[model samples]
Target: MLFNSYTFLVLFLPLTLVVFQLLRRGNQRMAMGWLVAMSLLYYGWWNPDPSKPWTPFYLILICTSCMINFWIGRFLAAHTFTPKGRLILGLGLTANLGVLFYYKYIGLFERTMEALTLGKFSIPDVVLPLGLSFFTFQKIAFLVDAYRGKTSKYNFLDFLLFVTFFPQLIAGPIVHHNEIMPQIQRTVSPSRRSVDLSVGISLFAMGLFKKVVIADNLAMVANPLFGAVAAAGGRDLTMLEAWAAAISYSLQLYFDFSGYSDMAIGAARMFGIKLPVNFHSPYKATSIVDFWRRWHITLSRFLRDYVYFSLGGNRKGPILRYSNLLITMLLGGLWHGAGWTYILWGGMHGLFLCVNHAWFALRKKLSIPALPKPLAIFLTFVVVVAAWVPFRAGAFELAANGSAQEALRATKSILASMFGLNGFEGWPNAAASEVKFSWAMRAMSCVLIVWLMPNSQQVMRRYFPSIGLRGLLAKTSMPGPRRFWQWRPTWQWTVFTVILVMGSIYEFDKVSEFIYFQF
Candidate 1:
C-alpha cells in the first residue's frame, strides 16, 4: 500500500505502530512476528482480490526466497573463507540472480528478440512481484557478506524481518546485513518511543507534503507535457516545451522517489528501527561522481561494493576502471526498469562519470585549478537533466507501446526539442498572477527549494537513523546538515507538523503510487 494513501494514513500505520509498541512491552519476539505479519499484509495489500493468480504465488515466492536465502546465509557463515564457502556463495548468487532475471529482464529480452526478427517471435509478459528488486538485493548482500565472514549470528526471524520490514521493503534505502539486523533486536522504551515518534511524524509529514502537495502537482504538469511530445512524434515541440517537460519530470522524480525514501525512513523510525539515508541534496552536487554519492545513496553503495569491486574496480588501470564504471551503470540503469531508455540513461551517467574522473586526473597532472563550485554544480545539473530525457521517456512509454525503440524515439524527440533542433520557442505568455500556481510557478518553487532550502535530512539530522552516512559526512569537506531548522518536541513544532500534515492530507483524493515502486 502507498504510504500516502488513506488506508495507510488512517488505518495501517497508526494501528501497526500502536500494536507493535504495545507488544514490545511484554514479548519482543511476538512484536517482531507481528511486524513481520503486518509487513506481509502490507506487501500483499496490492493484490487483495483472491482470484488474481499471482497474488499467492508472489507471497510464496518471496517467503520461499527468504527461507532459502536465510539458510544459505547461515551455511555460508558456517563455512566462511573456505573453498566450500565460495562455492556456496556462488551458487546462492546464481540462484538469486537467475530468479531476478526471470521476473525482471525476460520481458526486455523478448522485446529485443521481437525487434530483431520483426515480430517473428513473441513471449508472454512477466508481472514482477512487489519488493522483488529491493529484497533480492538485500538477500544477495547477505549471502556475499556471509562468505566474507562479515555476518554475525543471525536467527531466521531476524533474517526474515530484515528482508520483509515493510518500510524499506517496497523501494529502498537498499540496506545491508550489518546496518539493520542488530537494531531489530532492540526493545523500544517509552522515552525512546516519544522522541522517535516525534521525529518520525515530522519526517512522514514532510515527505507526505513533498509527495502530495509538490510532486503530484508537478506530475500533472510533466505527464501531459511528455505525453503530448510522444503523441506528436517528437517533431513539433519547442525548446521551452522540451525543457519544461524534462525539468518538470526530473524534479517530479526527485520529490516522488526521495519523498518515498523519507516516508520509509520515517515510518521505520516510529518503531525505533532506523533506515539509512537514501538521498542527500543531490542537485547540489558539483560533479557526476558527487551526484551519484548523494542520489539513491544506498544503491550507489551497493553497486560500488558488490558490482564495481567484483569487476576489479580501479585496480586494473584506467581503461578497466572506465569499463567497469560503464558496465556498472548499464546494469544500474537496467535495474531501474526493463527498458532501453533506462539503460541509455545509465550509460550517459557512466560516460559522464568517466569524463569527470578523467578531468580530475588531468587537473592533477597539469596543476589546473578546479572549476568554481557554483559553475561545476550548474554544469553537472545540466548534464544530469539531459541524461534524464531518456529515463523520463520510459515513463511515457507506458502510454506509448512499452517498446525500447519507442522509448528511444521519445527520448530523441524530447532531447531534440531541448537542444533547439525543434526551434526555440520562448516561455509561455501569461501574466504573473495568471501563471500563479501553474507548472511554471511550481517548477520555480521546486527549483528554489532544491537549490536553496535545507532538505528533510537536514531538518531531522538531530535524530540520526539506525545506520547511515554519519561517518562519511564527517569525512567530507561539505558542511553538515546542521545549517537548517532542527526538529524538536515542542507544542509550536507540533502545531507546525499538524498544519503540514493536514495540508498534505487535503490532497489525499489524488493519491498516486511512488515512482520507484515499479522497480
Candidate 2:
C-alpha cells in the first residue's frame, strides 16, 4: 500500500504504531512479531485482486526467495572463507540472479527475437513482482558479506525483519545487516518513542508535501508531452515543448523518488530504526561522479563495493578502471529495467565518469584550476538532465512493448527535439494554454528549492530519533551557514505542516503510485 494513501495513513499506520508501542511494554518479541505480521500484510495487500489474479503469486515468490537466501546466508556464515564456502556463495549468487534474470529479462529476450525474426514468435506477458529488483540485491549483498565474514551470524527472524521491514522493502536505501540489526535489538523507551514519532512525522510530512503537491502536479505537465512524442514514434517536437517536457520530467522524478526516500526513511525512524540516507541534494553536485555519490547513495555503494571492486576496480590501472565503470553502469542500467534505453543511459553515465576521471588526471598534470562552483553545478545539472531523456523514454517503451529499438527511437526523438534538430514549430497555442503557465512556474519553484533549500537532514541535524532534542530552540536553530531552513515546533511550523497535510489530503482522490514503483 502507498504511504500516502488514506487507508495507510489513517488506519494501517496508527493502528500498527499503537499496537506495537503497547505490545513493546510487556513483550519485545511479541512486538517484533506484530511488526513482521503487519509488514507481510502491507506487502501482500494488493493480492487477490479481481483484475490481477496473479498478484498473490508474488507473496509466495518473495517468501520462497527470502527462505532460500536465509539458508544461504546461514551456510555462508558457517563456512566462512573456505574454498567450499566460496563455492557455496557462488552457487547462491547464481541462484538469486537466475531467478531475477528469468522473471525480469525473459520478456525482453522474447521481444528481441520477435524483432529479429519479423514477428515469427510471440512474447508471453511477464508480471514482474514489485520490489524484486530491490530485495534481491539486498539479499545478494548479505550472502556476499557472510562469505567475507563481514556479517555476524543472524537468526532467521532478524533476517526476515531486516529484508521485509515494510518501509524500505519495496524501494530501498538497501539496508545492510550490520547497519540495521543492532537498532532492531534496542529496547523501546518512552523518550525514544516520543522522539521517533516527532522526527518521523516531520520527515513524512515534508515528503508527503513534495510528492502530492509538487511531483504529482508536475506529472500532468510531463506525461502527456512524452506520451505524445512516443506515440508519434519520436517524430516531432518543438524546442519549447521538448525543453518543457524534459525539465518537467527531471524535476518530477527528483521529487517523486526523493519524496519516496524521505517517506521510507521517516517510516523507519518512527520505529526507532534508521535507514541510510539515499539522496543528498544531488542536483547540487558538481560532476557526474559527485552526482552518483549523492543520488541513490546506497545503490552507488552497492555497485562500487560489490560490482566495481569485484571486477578489480581501479587496482588494475586506468584502462581496467574505465572498463569496470562501463561494465558496472551497463549492468546497473539493465537492473533498472529490461530495455536497451536503460543500457544506453547507463553507458552514457559511464562515459561521463570516464571523461571526468580523465579530466581530473589532466588537470593534475597541467595544474589547471577547478571550474567555479556555480558553473560546475550548472554543467553537471545539464548533463544529468539530458541523460534523463533515455531513462524516461525507456519507461514509456517498457510500459508498452518492452522493445529496445522502440526505446532507442523514442530517446533519439526526444534528444533531437531537445537539441532543436527538429523544427521550431512550437506547440499549438491551444495546446500550450491547456497546460497553462502555472506548471512552468511550479517547475521553476521546484528547481529553486532544490538549488537553495537545506535538506531534511540539515533541518533536523540535532534531532536524531533515538536522542531527545537538545533544546527546542537550540535544536531548531540553523546549524550551518548553508542551512537556511530549520524545523521548530513553533506556530509557523505548525501552520506550515497543517497546510501541507491538508493540501496533500485534498488531492487524495487522485492518489498516484510513485514513479519508482514500477521498477
Q: How high is the CA lDDT of each candidate model?
A: 0.84, 0.82
Worst 10 residues of 1 by lDDT: 428-437
Candidate 2, residues 304-378: lDDT per residue as tens digits? Answer: 999999999999999999999999999998888888888889999999999999999999999999999999999
Please, what are the lDDT tens digits per residue for candidate 1 over residues 1-519? 789988998999999999998998899999999999999888877773558553566778888999999999889989989999989899999999999999988877877887788885556667788878998999999999988889999888888899999999989979987878888887766898888888898888889999999899888877776776666443445677677777888899899987898889889989888888899989999999999989999999999999999999999999999999999999999999888888889999999999999999999999999999989888888888899888888865544256666777888888988898878886645541122235655684677789888788877766774366575467743334444267777788899999999999899889898989889
For model 1, which pairs clash? none
Which regions in candidate 2 have their CA more than 4 angstroms from the true location?
A: 52-55, 117-123, 233-235, 424-428, 431-434, 465-484, 489-492
TM-score of each: 0.94, 0.93
Clashes of 2: 0
